[model samples]
Target: MTLGLTGLLALGLATSVLAQDYQRPSISGIGAVAQPEQIAAWDIDVRPDGLGLPVGKGTAEDGEALFADRCAMCHGDFGEGVGRWPVLTGGHGSLTEERPEKTVGSYWPYTSTLFDYIYRAMPYGDAKTLSPDEVYALSAYILAENQIVEYDQELNQDNFAQIEMPNRANFFADDRAVSEAYSERCMSGCKAEDINIVSAAPELDVTPEE
Candidate 1:
């Protein structure tokens, strides 16, 4: 009886020790591996209403010079995109058509978006190397070529945001979520046959099946 009690106590103690040994590391949450500050450098983006434009100034004349040297190789001397790159100017009233060839001047809702896009990702090969002044100048030249602004006008932090775009009110946010809630909720009698199969493909058909 004494030996059995001793064995049982030893087994219980071993089980308790094993249970105590099972431990997880202190750091295991999503935030444990996430570095918040590392993303700041890669998160540069400018919004409409000139929310994120850095402080700088550039004239259309200066922009023309810079564009000729750096941008013209790809964008052409007149802001017309090379062979298949894209066209920057024109396309004023084509947005109403079925297939509108949108450009910087015609399709862009805000002028600031142009400066933001070019400043962050232009010159194709070398990006984020242009100074604030150079970015402003490049923006000015492109805008001039698009005929949105005059060649002599100066684009700075103050006036760049104020430049009104032709398509400022052309864009509308997703109204289906807010305005079309009734339409989405009116599917009481579900009709699978009535669904438009022409508009939406079911899945990728790899095989030639009828």
Candidate 2:
């Protein structure tokens, strides 16, 4: 097609704009490097060995009121969970049952996970708002509710690693690499038996009809 004067000018302008965008100098110093203190603020992960636990202490007694105030709406008074929310207590020795009730006391392999999770995320809409002491208190309360710790027993960084989960022995490192069966990749003519279709989608009445 023959280009009109206006079309030619528009095309030239677009090409020039594209060329300018491609050749534009990169921006410099848009943001400063993060300071050590600033990086420390976000590096708040607590390890299984209680390495990153902050200096603080609290008891289940202190946590009960805090739980009611900050967490009861969804978690219930005793951590039985409200509606569809997660149940935090009970479910002991139920792992072998047909339907296991996995709770903190029942299935969690580490207590550090509980503390870390509560600290990083909790209180529904508001996350990371709880203080270190408050987090300890909440952890203690949940532990107490699960009968893992006494109600008045204080929890701190020093003794936190000593508290073990009931299901800790059940969990182990993945051994699929060594334990599971591995074989060479198979393509065509791998199976000795002939393949047969058990049923069709139409016969099973699973396909939607127009």
Candidate 1 worst ten-residue window by lDDT: 196-205
- Please, what is the TM-score per model? 0.66, 0.71
- The per-residue C-alpha lDDT of model 1 at residue 184 equals 46
Cα lDDT tens digits, model 2, 118-151, are 9999877899999999999999999999999999
Q: Which segments of model 1 are wrong by more than 4 Å?
A: 1-43, 176-210
lDDT to native, each model: 0.80, 0.92
Question: Any residue pairs clashing in model 2, and if so which?
Answer: none
Among the numbered candidates, top lDDT falls to 2
Kindly list the per-residue Cα lDDT of model 1 for residues 1-210, writing each as its tens digit.
256988999988877746567886685555554466775666667776777777889888998878888878777888777888778888889988997878888888788788877878877888888988998888888888878888889898888988888887888878897766664455477675776556434466555767
lDDT, residue 143, model 2? 96
